[model samples]
Target: MITLWLFILIGAVIAFFWFGRQIAEAAQQHAVGQAEKLNVQLLSVACVKRRLAVLSNGRLGIKSQFAFEFSSDQQSAYTGTMHLENLRLKKMDIPPHRMG
Candidate 1:
């Protein structure tokens, strides 16, 4: 029984990281698309935060928030956020940045 429980725990840990990686990839794609649409350069996209919350659209999901750095003029750096819901982009909150 102890060995069986250990296997279950290990499986859960693996699944957790697997899902997290998938979510991070989706968030990165969303962030890149958003930055391109805004005519900014995506410097970096990192999965820096995560939470379980009900979205404003009234959907209960795992919210994976990625913090991204962007540059419009290739000089000034700016920060933005991309929110993902189970590997789907739920919302994007990017403040106005410089435009080149």
Candidate 2:
């Protein structure tokens, strides 16, 4: 009886490890699929922004302000100010930036 109990204990440990590995692999595959979809959608959007900066509002997980320069044609320049809602961008202000 003691030997049988020992064998069952070892089996339980092996099963736990196998189940954990399978769950982690499934989560990683889901993340990869979502990233691929985002890449395709971003390619369709023609706007390009650069020289970005993020400002925090002194609260946890809250971005108070953001500033960047973007040009749709990649030739002209403009500065943008974005407002955040629930950690996502809600509004954007992009006026023309004077070039030298």
Q: Identify the candidate with maximal TM-score.
A: 1
Question: Candidate 1: lDDT of 41?
Answer: 86
Clashes of 1: 0
Least accurate stretch of 10 residues (summed lDDT) in model 1? 52-61
What's the C-alpha lDDT at position 2 in model 2? 98
Best by lDDT: 1
> What stretches of model 2 exceed 4 Å from their correct place?
40-100
lDDT tens readout by residue for model 2, 29-95:
4333433533321111122322223435444332233444444444654554555432345465546
Model 1, runs deviating above 4 Å: 51-61
Candidate 2 local distance difference test against the native: 0.43
Q: What is the C-alpha RMSD of each candidate to the true structure, in Å?
A: 2.3, 14.5
Candidate 1 to native Cα RMSD, angstroms: 2.3
Clash pairs, model 2 backbone: none
Error of 1 at 2 (Å): 1.2
